[model samples]
Target: MAPTSETLTAERILEATEEVLRRHGPAKATVVDVARALGVSHGSVYRHFRTKAALREAVTKRWLDRTSEALSGIVAEDRDPEGRLRDWLRTLFEAKRRKAGDDPELFATYTVLTDENGTAVGEHLADLTAQLTRIVRAGAEAGSFETTDPEATARAVFHATGRFHDPCHAREWERPGVEEEFTAVVDLLVRGLRGR
Candidate 1:
């Protein structure tokens, strides 16, 4: 059987929204653009998402889900903390490379780093840091790390990784070895945490 009207409508709106985000970016994409793409009225789009912020949040969440799944896959298979951290960092850097042509506005909206001030935006990053900190604490307990402040270390490493993976960095813009260099930096970080 075919999908219900509501299901089909929802799918159409999401598709339209993605297209608009790609074409005009998140800040510029409006309900009208999505409505036009879906061949529906603006009211119909509103019926699915009451506000533009909600829709944008949904988009950002979807992107994060994709990222989380990628990271989780790496961690799930590697029980070694050092290996797991290496894989996780490599996956993130690789994702960035793969997303080079992706919508910049969408990317910016989905980042967890901007929530440094404990504000609403920081809420998501806080959760992510908590999770990473848990892993760091475990590693420390297992003698894989030499840190008394796993939470702080995790936060610092997270920010450092972001700097290394920055899209507009001069070295990142240089050539093909950027991915390898990113992984090397991650390896160095893990080794330093081991304190050997």
Candidate 2:
């Protein structure tokens, strides 16, 4: 049976594109392959995403958003900002590590896609830093953190913890004592942020 428009949404196309990329890698994957995976025409996939780059970008955004979505709740919770910040960082690290370890092929595909789709990656970084800024701002308001510029502070913290969450450093994630080093870094960051 032909898939109706409702069934052939952009989301479905992106999902199929992801599978195609996972199997064939970015260099070999094509819109037609994504369409073939969905049993649809290439035109059908193009209707949802104007170009292959667009579809790839959308899939990359979706993959990055998974980590952001996982950490979003910690920002919304009414707990101490310090605790929320710690939870958010740990959750993000775990999410990235899981993606890299559990589905390395797809994760590697996304790493390439993310490099190609700089705009999507930028937006994702902005969203993450925004979340961090909120947590920092809350901590400041509660007299637990000292930062005149939460946005800058958040960005600093994000960069400082990059090795723990960045895909480029994924290979080191499983090294012995990596988790201990991660805890040490987080503790130092939190300590530096603490209000006098």
Candidate 3:
């Protein structure tokens, strides 16, 4: 049971759900499990999430938001757009690697949660791509980049760098010399975006 002092808000529920998901994994984690972890009834959880799928989707979005929120700070930095772009991408790679390495169980659980919650995943991607677009557009405005289509260019850069950040490519992130490969890819991407 949660301490009585701690209210069972949506945030608390999401937090407990994440722990539950981590403990039992996506295949077996349930609302009852989350409620049990909270020392509340399943009915209380439903009052906040409405449905079992709703709870899962909310938890998945919360998980993805950790990365998105971190990247958004880089996007908001008032630095050379090219440098900001590089830092942004590197930060993304580091964040993904940390998630996979620091908590292998939770990371594996999120892989399944993400698959089951496409809308959450889609929104996360859109948020990420939008952040990238802001950086690309800023570069174009400063004449640091040549592309007129910042949105398209952002999309390309994102897809091109997917191996660094995509969970599906998690296996490749720790390969020997993968950091060199990531640097090479980033260099090529930055060079491609720069003016002649």
Candidate 4:
């Protein structure tokens, strides 16, 4: 089935926004720039997104959704709790890198460490960590992982992994061996979870 006109318009606007961000960076990618790229009036963009912050949020949400969609299938296919845990981290790092390259806000996760309204970014991190902890706990219960504190372990692992996945951090170590280094970290994390 074909997409509705509204859907196409939204996608076009997002594509334009992505291009704008790539060219001008997030701080400079204004709604006017997006509107001009789409040859639409500023009001048109506003109709879909009431504020520039709203638009940026949508872009960030869409980027996360896309990354989730890519990995959800793979995650579902595996049941080995230890392997699944490892795969989750591996997928996350890959997805993080992919999103950082495509969406500027994702890269900012490391630098800003706060919500636009000045709240600690730990809230955002906690949401994801909680979800991951559930999975890790399941693994622990099944004997695939031997964690005395699955929740804390998950949170620590997530924070450590974020150091590599965040664009600012990735940029500092941007070289051929970086991926290998990240891979080793994840490997060790998974091994630790397995009580090996």
- Put down candidate 4 lDDT per residue, 1-196, tens digits, no spaces: 5533355476677777767776766666799998888777889888888898777766655554565565555546547666666677778777767656665553564233224522333444555676678778878888888889989988878877876755457564446887788888888887877786
Clashes of each: 1, 0, 0, 0
Candidate 2: the clashing residue pairs are: none
Query: After best superposition, candidate 3 residue 23: deviation in angstroms?
Result: 1.0
Clashing pairs in 4: none
Please identify which of the two predictions, 1 or 3, would achieve the higher lDDT against the true structure.
3
lDDT of 2 by residue, 79-174 (tens): 899999999999999999999999988888888888899999999999999999999999999999999999999999999999999899999998
* Every model: Cα RMSD to truth: 4.0, 1.1, 1.8, 4.4
Score residue 54 of candidate 1 by CA lDDT: 66
TM-scores for all candidates: the values are 0.76, 0.97, 0.96, 0.72
lDDT, model 2, position 140: 94
List ranges where model 1 is wrong by over 4 Å.
1-4, 9-12, 101-124, 166-176
* lDDT score, candidate 2: 0.92
Ranking by lDDT: 3, 2, 4, 1
Candidate 4 or 3, higher lDDT: 3
Pairs that clash in candidate 1 = 115-122
Q: What is candidate 3's lDDT per residue for 40-100, written digit by digit as tens? A: 8888888889999999999899999999999999999999999999999999999999999
Model 3 ranges off by over 4 Å: 1-6
Q: List per-prediction Cα lDDT, in the order shown.
A: 0.67, 0.92, 0.93, 0.68
**What local lDDT does model 4 show for residue 190?**
78
Ranking of candidates on TM-score, top first = 2, 3, 1, 4
Q: Looking at model 1, report the run of 10 residues with the lowest lDDT sum.
A: 109-118
